[model samples]
Target: MNNTIKILLAEDEPSLGQIVKESLETRNFEVFHVENGEEAYKIYKEEQPAILVLDVMMPKKDGFTLAKEIREENSTIPIIFLTAKSQTKDVLEGFSHGGNDYLKKPFSMEELIVRIHSLLNRVEKIKDVEKIKIGNYTFNYKKQTLELDNISNLLTHREAELLYNLWQQKNEVLDRTFILKKLWGNDDFFNARSMDVFISKLRKKLKKDENIQIVNIRGFGYKLMC
Candidate 1:
């Protein structure tokens, strides 16, 4: 919260976008509002905001496509999908595509503020550790990686960082925001969903060890048990 939190908001609705921009600005967030997916991507590269809010239905590529492209370049930025589509499939698709959170359209600005703050709070809890040994996985914190039996998974930059953060906390619950911030730099819906994808992937990768489990804490976060 001490840092000036920058946001890249991509929405095709001019009035709604403007209102959101103004509301966020009033609460001290620096928001750059754009109308289309292409502009969102361009401004994203230029501004490198701390978080991104994207409308699912937009011109010049949808939010889903934009999120994918952004993930290709930077896998760690927090992303939230704003959409009227409430289908379970759409929500799952958003998560599968690396979204941290998803908000249905006509949401309250106060709720949005709380979500943003919560996400940022989690991101701030991750600190560097010296090393962590999870079953056969040997993680070197400085390198931000996990290696098993001399083989390396060659994780995404943020992926490795998240692993280190989880290891630092060990059996404790790593709040969703903490992992989101450590990996995606925000805890927005898009980023939260994306973290779930990564967590599943990591769990599968480490299935060789029955001694370790990434237990879902049901509504809160995850615990990396040793």
Candidate 2:
């Protein structure tokens, strides 16, 4: 699995790009490097790399735009932004665009490797839990479906993610801020409202189980009670 892990790298700097590709290769990560966002997008569609490392400033499409496009197609893939911008706003923007991690320019190759490993490990853990029972609903994370009384409903990627988080913290309050960051990458007003809509949808789906309840804690968060 180590050698099979693929990374899509988009950076315009020849020297840095070569170095990064070689460094990741040494770590047993298969990397495909592109000099522009257009090429990156093309390769990503063709290869469907396990992870993405993007530079903020690039020719054709920028990293943020590339990431957004990718997220529209795949919501779960890990994305890391490589950029010189270190401002808080820039970091927030990276997250808003679906970046899983951010690393500033002139970063240590070792640190980049570590961040990649960490993100991969986190994803592995999530995948390891094949299915979970929540109240009367059985959620198969692998299939991204929920079953109640032998009736199964296919879930969208975001719906499955939100449901998984709630199930993990069942019978406990999950902070809205934490949930927004975990699922949407940010906790801004727009994302917050978006989360509310998802929560509502989830409630309606789980309504078949009378014993299950998702209660909103005003000014705080939500609790999944069974």
Please estimate how well model 2 matches the true structure, expressed as its whole-model Cα lDDT.
0.85
Q: Return the lDDT, model 1, position 26.
A: 89
Tens digits of lDDT, candidate 2, 199-220 = 9989999998799999999999
lDDT (tens digit, per residue) of candidate 1 on 1-226: 3656899999999999999999999898999999999999999989889889999999998999998888777655767889998765787688657676778888999878877876566556545556678998877654545688888655544456566667767899989876676445467786676678778877887788899998999988989898
Model 1, position 82, has a per-residue lDDT of 94
**Model 2, residue pairs in steric clash:** none
What lDDT score belongs to each candidate, Candidate 1 first? 0.79, 0.85
Question: Best candidate per lDDT, number?
Answer: 2
lDDT for position 72 in model 2: 75
Off by over 4 Å in 2: 128-167, 170-226
Q: Lowest lDDT 10-mer window, candidate 2?
A: 122-131
